[model samples]
Target: MAMIEDAGRRRALRTLTAGALAAGGGLLSVRAFAGGLATVNMQLGWVPGGNQVGEVVAKRLGYYEKEGIDFHIQPGGPNIDGVAIVASGRFQTGEISSSPSIMLAVSEGLPIKCIAVGLQQHPYTFFSLKKAPIRSPQDMIGKRIGIQSTGMVLLRALLAKHKIPENQVKIVPIGADMMPLVAGQVDAVTGWQTNTTALKPLGADRVDLRLWDTGVRLYALPYYATTSMLKEHPETVQGFLRATARGWMYANQNRDQAIDMLVKDYPNLNRADERVAIDSLMHYAFDQTTQTQGWGAMDAAVWEEQIAMYGQLGQFRAAQPKVDDVMTLDVLKATHSSRLKV
Candidate 1:
């Protein structure tokens, strides 16, 4: 990989690597981490939970072991810079929370490419109460839209997609809390529709305006690897994809057992909550496209659409990255039969 020009980013990644080694019980390696199995430390964009049920199932069921792989999931929090970590070669691969992240990273000259999409349709939604419903982009007009500073881009994309003037909607900067929306502080709040834990406060009367429905299509839970890793070890990357596909397929087919395995892996996760949340999670994971194309499926047209939208919104600092720079079909193509098994 070319040298990463940003010094602070490199330092942050170095610190993260050291800390991950210490906190992870020891240093880990891909080819020679443990018993000669190819190791893949998957750095998550958030703390482990129901989103990782498939991986947890895979590990517990020895699916990775069957593929001669030692997969480790490293947790990421608000402080963790997962993209930097993956770009710095600290980890073999990483999974970000959303697809836009990959595009933004590539625009900044990050040497990473999305290998597969975990969720075909992004779960990001504009949540509102039933009383003052903002069911569509038109409803956003004159409404105080509560969103995090980080999510401003999403709101902008929604507006740009529908040609809604930015001044029409009031952008209310707020944390990820439903209280603001509940107390009539704002008309709506932005969050992942699958985040049932966080959505508990909104009550059943909540109205959801999904980002995808607003024409700002995006992918969530996208897996990516450094460009160097893809070129150096294509077979290893293919192996990881194959095993991961099997894990997800198993989780889709056997939901109860998957949740059972998930709770076992992470004792902190409540079984009841995960059980209820799995249905919503599965809905995003397997849709019509998944029924025909199988799991971990994605369409290039969608990626191109996101790129064009973000580019038009001036979200890309450097020159806009090509579709190939943002993602690759090789890994997905290599594991076609296994991923297609459904």
Candidate 2:
């Protein structure tokens, strides 16, 4: 979904201007409804599905309402520029599929800053059959790697980190299908490990080489807001994080019930697929770090590492972004006690 479309989406983000963002000020303020619940709309860069399970669970269970938030999700597609929309203040907050979108946007002078990350480690991985296993970055050499056009940069970063020359591997640009790999057109294909349904055809012979394990560290499903929103409405942001963290924790502990609520909220999602997907999703969401720091916790060092890696790759089109420009921990700090730990 979002991982496949980011290359073009980053280009769309660069088109946002100060004048256009200023025009959206009329809808910037957090609107309070008749019951004094503030409206908080979360704009996304991809269509809602398994990735939004926590939010769906929260909304269906009244967690947002308990936090005094009238939360709503604004769906995004290929034609929509979710980052620009949030930067322009049309939506109070936004959650993009990958962390680089936020860094790249901020470097281009967008006023948004990441407040919390939903997944501590990105689930993007290189998948190969056991017969020709690509278990590590070095194993990718001399192989045909099937990747989406937008994910070429990720492959570049992985190669760069491991000091492998780009020419060593054959890069095959393909659509979001695993058929190329299965048909021997490519040795491996790239996709999120949490996408169980898509990975079904690959079967038990599938081998995963995750992007995070390759030293190309990145966050997924990052929650962000404009600088003004973080400054003017910190409490609202904290409340949202608290409720969301609780929702994820609940989903982790009560799997079947969470998927039931999720499908009920969005009838289009198949319960069986989401139920299978959440297990993989939770593994990335909670780990040794989240056990102590709690859900949504992030380290400045990780942000700095991501910035340095992306900068070295020459991904930034404008001024290089500093760590502070990309993310802030105030909201996470405020909601620490409220978040559940594993």
Candidate 3:
């Protein structure tokens, strides 16, 4: 548990370091193209798994290649600072776990902006047993909430939204697991609802209270690039989004093939676990909004809501970043036609 939390802290520090460097000095401007094909290394905030099924499916099917992109997936671990790597111009793009990260980075004057969202609604949820259920924010009162130290802000946001007094809920520092809750150490635990592997131990007794449903709507799996990349090569970004969207569309239509491609690409993953996880994962990836607006769809209004919420939480030490400063819908607008088809 300590190791997992420590890894999260180290990743945050890396993101902060990149932002500080951007504010104090400047980030290098890397060329968008390499040789004949446009090279793109997508840095992930955590180890590659079911969250990246679409990307794996896309790469396996040569979707990126057809789009004139030599795409590479750079797995991020506790030691690797994916955001910093992208900000430093060492990588072409990055995708983080949550939307707050983009806002936090931009607030610190990081030279990056989110271009598209992978999951329209965040899957971060609070899990509890049926015996002592916590189905809503209000139910959290008087209950021991097991969460990672880094996720304190989310707990705070939920409390604030529901007008629950902070002191009512007991905060139990725990890792990203169900053990603490299973051992009766805490009443509830925090993790992504889409991670079937992690949620398995909790059994059928598990009850979910998602953060997004609590009125703290947040985008997850947001893709970002340096401000320079957006300015210098907008076309490249558009191409990347187009191919990626197609990949997700394909995965949604053909689940079996997507899982096969995923397991083939990354041998370490359990085929059975990933197979079950993708059902929950895809549910968040494509909702009614995606049915109309297409995959990677995001709203500026939602970004504004998140910024305001985080602002109220005092998460931003520097100047509060405008919605435009954190994200741009230009790429989404440009690829609207193809995105709609997907």
Candidate 4:
């Protein structure tokens, strides 16, 4: 009976040993199964805007290396379209503006998902001079405003919601220096808070009406990934997010240096103006909505409602995307910051 019991124990031990070997071999196979290349690549929308800073720093500072990521940055423009590049399986991941990415992805049947939002709110902000006596968006009725493009849909939504007739305002194309408003070419400019930073030196103060008030309550742009990538290589996406969370934190606290680094990569453009853009970008990057949740927290209701507004303006042809349809909140799991809300 004793001998029989010992044999049974040996058989169980052998089985355990075989299982351990199989598990160890399976792990090695998974590691070897990683997508080839020592680096993971991503495309970015702009060349040197505040939007691309975290990715830029992650590359320059070797944080991506620590995360085992290889970045292939394909810098385009505020105007250059990368939706196809991101959606067609050419690149594993990239960033388009969050709102537009969501809207476009839903409209065109793309498989992209917004995994992380870098800022708390939209970065597009309006600025009037400190001495202009204009306190809010409602105060600007019938005033001439300089604008970057008339194609902007959110401005239209604000106008529609505020009951301001489209014809009541005069619109003009402007530059980063607030040249139109400065030269009395217009009442105020709808340029970014960063582009108008130079206005302070030119005898004007600025207000981040988005933060200071409740006019354009849009969400911040986000980093993105494909559905296939999320399913196939979740670890890569998670690593990228971990590196990116640190990158945004770095960009937010290290403003001037981030700008300086940006200028190093993007020279000959206006540096001072770019700094304001960067600072404002960071300001909008971290906001109350984002603060309450994780760094990339988003409400599907807010996004769908905004998309519906765009659809009303003829920007889209489809029904508003379901909140879960366009955006997902899973990547925030990559952050170890217990302070992260959502």
Q: What are the clashing pairs of model 2? A: none
Give the candidate number with the greatest TM-score.
Answer: 2
How well does candidate 1 score on lDDT at residue 243? 81
Q: Candidate 2 local accuracy as lDDT?
A: 0.87
Q: Please give the RMSD of candidate 2 to the true structure.
A: 2.9
What lDDT is reached at residue 290 by model 3? 84
Candidate 3: which pairs clash?
none
TM-score of 2: 0.93
Report the error of model 4 at residue 23, Å: 37
Instruction: Write one digit per residue (lDDT tens) for candidate 4, span 119-156.
Output: 66565666666666446667667777676553345567
lDDT of each candidate versus the true structure: 0.85, 0.87, 0.85, 0.61
Candidate 4 lDDT at 142 equals: 74
Model 4 residue 297 CA deviation in Å: 3.3
Q: Between the candidate structures 1 and 4, which one is better when assessed by TM-score?
A: 1
* Model 2: lDDT of residue 147: 96
- Cα deviation at 327, candidate 1, in Å, is 0.6
* Window of ten residues with lowest summed lDDT in model 4: 1-10
Better of 2 and 3 by TM-score: 2
Question: Could you give the candidate ranking by TM-score, starting with the highest?
Answer: 2, 1, 3, 4
lDDT of candidate 4 at residue 297, scale 0 to 100: 63
lDDT of 1 by residue, 201-294 (tens): 8889999999998888999999999888898888888888888888888998899999999988899998888888888999999889887777
